[model samples]
Target chain A: MSELLHRRTVVKELLKKRGDMVVIGGLGAPAWDITAAGDHDNNFPLWGAMGAAAMIGLGLALAQPKRRVLVVTGDGEMLMALGALATIAVQKPKNLSIVVLDNEHYGETGMQRTHTGYGVDMAGMAKAAGFARTMNITAQKDVLRLRPLIDGMRGPLFAQVKIDAEKLPLVLPPREASYIKNRMRISILGPEAALHQ
Target chain B: MTTVSKAAKPAARAAARRPRVAAPRPAPAAPKPVMPAGTSHWAEQVHPMLVEAGIRQVGLVPDAGHSRLIQLCEADKSMRIVRLTTEEEGVALLAGAWLGGEKGVLLMQSSGVGNCINMLSLPVACSMPLLILVTMRGDHGEFNAAQVPMGDSTQAVLEAVGVLVKRADIAADVPEMVSSGLRLAFNTFRPVAILIGQRVSGAKDFRKLTQPAGDINE
Candidate 1:
């Protein structure tokens, strides 16, 4: 079996060529991962909200319709809102993708083991829920394959990206929710969005 | 007798008739659904106003209190209604929608309000527009004891989370309150809660909400 990839490295690879893609980072580590990938105006990182990243992705996917929407969240966070997998599939926004970093622990809450570590299958759930594309990535090479697939826009896609369970340095993104929101609005809708903020 | 194409009737009838699998049942003639007594139609009244105010997205968890509003959003071609498995998800959906230059509202019952305390922080933290239409439970002849505590404390709980609470107990007040809520949320960029009173949503008849899978003559 190939070695499990690092979360930051995996996120970096996925986000490297994300031009104009709207990236939604789930609370905690995934938010940090997006920042480590180089935070941009299009990045709307969740600082405190849990179990919301994917549905938020659904809303954005429905709203933008044209732009690619990516949601990066941890396994714990993903589990907290598993029904979203079904909801997203029903909405079937082809431009949206959910990349779950399966580190198998609640990294923010004292590293307690989560359901994924005990073999709860999120990718299987997504596939059963009718996601157009589903991936369970365990190696570095598989990460490369995703780049082209996401580019194809044959989504709504679900990827359970298995990564090392080791805790790493916290490379935090912007914490201010309003600031993160306004910048993302400006990026997506330009000056008109700023007036609302 | 009805506006919807008979969603709730068959289910309620299906629940009423029992042990139909064993016996050969006749073709059930569905009875005309009598709209609940004193039907406020508050939800029906507010649906157009929300559309008029440029609000389109609707995120909700299933509840009898929000049945009409949910149906209204579902039927509208311009509005996008998202059915949430839990109430807290609506908070994040609205936040995402607002950032994407769209407007939306959250519909929930009092019991679901407890599920949202943590996530509600996202809107308050961002100062984003969050408009919630809550149908209260545990008040005004509620049958379910479990819903009582959350219902009694819904306002205080919402206030503690920094939401501006506006309660409407009767049918007439709902439209104006909802409009004010939209103004507070969309114009002021603040979170406003329109707590629909128990009497308005007819919280007492909640047991008659959903029936079993099979059809019945009753």
Candidate 2:
């Protein structure tokens, strides 16, 4: 078995050179991971909506076809809405990339073993669903390879990056959903197109 | 010999037999003809309305009632039709569309509403403009008992999740109702649902299709 890479390090590396990319962090740890990397106006981290990160990425990708859209989610969150993989594959937006930070455990719910821990393959599911690109990263060196896929890959891509399930200090993003939403809209579409006046 | 007639409840049958006498109305001096004829296909009217309203992304889970509308949407070059595996994904998808400055809507049947309940929190919390078109089942002419519970609770369920619910029972009224719903949702940035009732969408009668094609024992 390969050594597990740290989730925060991988997220930071992915977003280090992220230029104008729209990022959707799935609920819980993935949300914290992206926030920990850096809080930006373009980052729309989920405070709730557990299984919706990738689907949200699909919508954003389709809506903003020119901008790269990344969904940084956990394995548990990915497992909850595995059907989204099929939905996204059918759409096939070139700008979309989903990275599941597989910690093997449901980190938020007292670290119980998730489907991924019991050998459910997230990347395999995406490949089966017809994603153009799929990656399984279990080593630190492979984390760097994922950066180009997030930045410039011609893909509706999916990557399951195996990370250590070690609990880390919370790095919370803005809890107000409206604020987060409008902030992202202003950043992407300017205030004129922002919702709720 | 026909089981379809037997399927209707006695009270409903009695109401259908009663003659409906509508009150007389005065004619307008000038009729502004923005709407199509009352007999126009509801989906036909709705498809253009959505396009005109600047709906750029359409997320849908296939339903028999909205099949024509889905086809129309798919054919529209300007709109991107996203086929969702389940209805809940559409809720999040529309939210993402709004975040990216594009308007989107979700089309699904009443049964899919149950799948969307948890995800509805995302839109409700963010106050994203979510427009949903739900084709009802189990209401007037339904043959399936399984679809009844969700159909009956669809409006109440949507309303409970802070979604403004509107029902169009008459086919002619669907276009206007949907137009108003579009305004209410986009303008106010609220989650709004337009429930196309079984009367408007037409209930499914499986008995007609299930009738013996020929003598099976032959």
The docking category that best describes candidate 1 is medium
State the displacement of the C-alpha of residue A171, model 2, in Å, after optimal TM-score superposition: 0.7
lDDT against the true structure, each candidate: 0.86, 0.89
Where does candidate 2 stray beyond 4 Å? Answer: A195-197, B1-39, B212-218
Using Cα atoms with residue i matched to residue i, what is each candidate's TM-score against the true structure? 0.86, 0.89
Per-residue accuracy of model 1 over B110-145 as CA lDDT, tens digit each: 889999998888889999889999988998778889
How well does candidate 1 score on lDDT at residue B8?
82
Report RMSD (Å) for each prediction in the order shown: 11.8, 7.5
The DockQ figures for the candidates are 0.53, 0.80
Candidate 2: pairs in clash: none
- Output the number of the lDDT-best candidate: 2
Error of 2 at A32 (Å): 0.7
Number of backbone collisions per candidate: 0, 0
lDDT of 2 by residue, B1-218 (tens): 74555557787788887868874586764322223456557888889999999999999999988988998998999999898889999999999898888899899998999999989999999988899999998776688999899888898899998999998887778899999999999888899999988776566566666768663322
Candidate 2, residues A1-197: lDDT per residue as tens digits? Answer: 66779999999999997889989999999999999999999999998888999999988998899999999999989998999999999988999999999989999999999988889998999999999999998888888888786677589999999889989999999999999988999999877757344
